[model samples]
Target: MSSRKFSIVSGFFLQDDQVHATPATIGALPPRFGLVDDSPECWSKFKSRIAELNDNASSGTTYKVFFLGRHGQGWHNVAEAKYGTRAWDDYYSKLYGDSEMTWGPDPLLTALGVQQAETARTAWLKEIPNGMPTPQRCFASPLHRALSTWQITFASDESFPQVMRKVMILENLREEHGVHTCDMRDSRSLIERNFPPPTYGFELGFTEEDAVWQADVRETKDHIKGRAQSVLDRIFDDTEETYISITAHGGIINGILAAVGRPSYSLPTGGVLPLVIRGDDV
Candidate 1:
């Protein structure tokens, strides 16, 4: 892979204290979707600004906008909530789930999760008319929850056709891998059965079964950040899409944000964060 680094570009988004202080929840588009200045055509202006940045960028450098979306409430989320973070991390996460639910080896979304995804879909529908650029490309974690979230949010509607909204599943985008059954993804064949190709595509070298996940070894945050950087570098090197979307887990998205030097902010289930970043070959 090419040696590349990324940095957050402020001034375009309302990532200022005021907006970041607010709770980022499902369907809660940051005040005017975090536009630095409010206007009827704010999104259009923002799009133009991105184009200008790329057009003026020196060779080996490019600017792109990323929409980082967290998957809706999975059974694991509910399990963690019920069990509390400490207990869940120590005990519950290792097992499949409690008696009431099963969240392991890629659990499906809970009902609330589905509702949250629908809310995300509605949010996108409301913004498109406001000049929000439909994502030129969409990427998702191999995990089922993230895949389902992407399907509901971007691919469910006829307004966004499949040709325009192709989703690529990336293994590196999966949540901090290992130990937690919730982090373990299902077999690729199973995933393909549900989210079949023509619309859903897997990254090159994707394996048939879970390859990186190991039940005994949990990945460190530093390792997750490194993985995030690797995937970002791959995307920057291979794709020309200016507007991109990634549906992934909280830890994975957090690593992505941190890798780009953005402030840390927790996204509620189904929540989305928009960031503008510049990548330079080192």
Candidate 2:
């Protein structure tokens, strides 16, 4: 980790009025103070401070040299609007068999989602073509909305689109699990068939069956934070990239920020935030 070349992939200060982060350049995210990831001394200091900052009854996402993205709008967004978050969380699947909820266990992006992703695609095109770094690697949650958004945001039709070949599906990157019907994913078998091998690679290390999804379980702040930490550790330890992109959900992004002691931020559907891991931080 110490020797890895660190850089950024997009993002702004937590207080920004807007969701999208500015393009990669010095002086981006004006209000953000102190390189969030500095060195080992700073990392220890940050952990102690985060341990204190995390005193609220409810707990926290942060990342470095990473592109954090939320899945675009989904059928679940519409359902939640009609039914509200509480009931939609509690009874949508049982009452409507998921058709009225997020369309199914693994929700797909809506037309609006595709439109939102296209908007994101426009941003990425400008950024990537204008000297911003393209991802050295890419990862997406197995959920349809996430995978779909990944496809739209990163896909290129040029003669050599090798980056597409490099994308991998990371089950750990999926959103908070099992609380809402829309969050429950499709069967692993179906997922594997849909995502396929190294060509459309699903990480081989992922398990065949979901380990979570208990009827009574809802991912707590601690749960999410731990998951965020675990995922970040895996990425930083294993990746060859100085830059990366994660197509996942708002909750996971939130968790990541909090866990890493960075200022908490929000990323709406198709929203993208860029972060850097200064070489000093591990």
| Per-residue accuracy of model 2 over 23-81 as CA lDDT, tens digit each | 33322122112234434354345434433433431311223356677788898777777
Per candidate, the number of residue pairs that clash is 0, 14
Instruction: Write model 1 residue lDDT over 1-282, tens digit each, in one string.
Output: 786889888777655342444544323466555666678888888888888999999999999888888899999999999999999999999999778999997989999999988988888888788888888889999999999999988888989755546799999999998999999888989999999997899988899999888989999988988999998998898888888899998899889877887656777888887878789999
Which residue window of length 10 is worst by lDDT in model 1?
18-27
**All candidates' TM-scores?**
0.94, 0.73
How does model 1 score by TM-score?
A: 0.94
Q: How close is candidate 2 to the true structure, as a TM-score?
A: 0.73
Top candidate by TM-score: 1
Candidate 1 CA-lDDT value? 0.85
What C-alpha lDDT values do all the predictions have? 0.85, 0.63
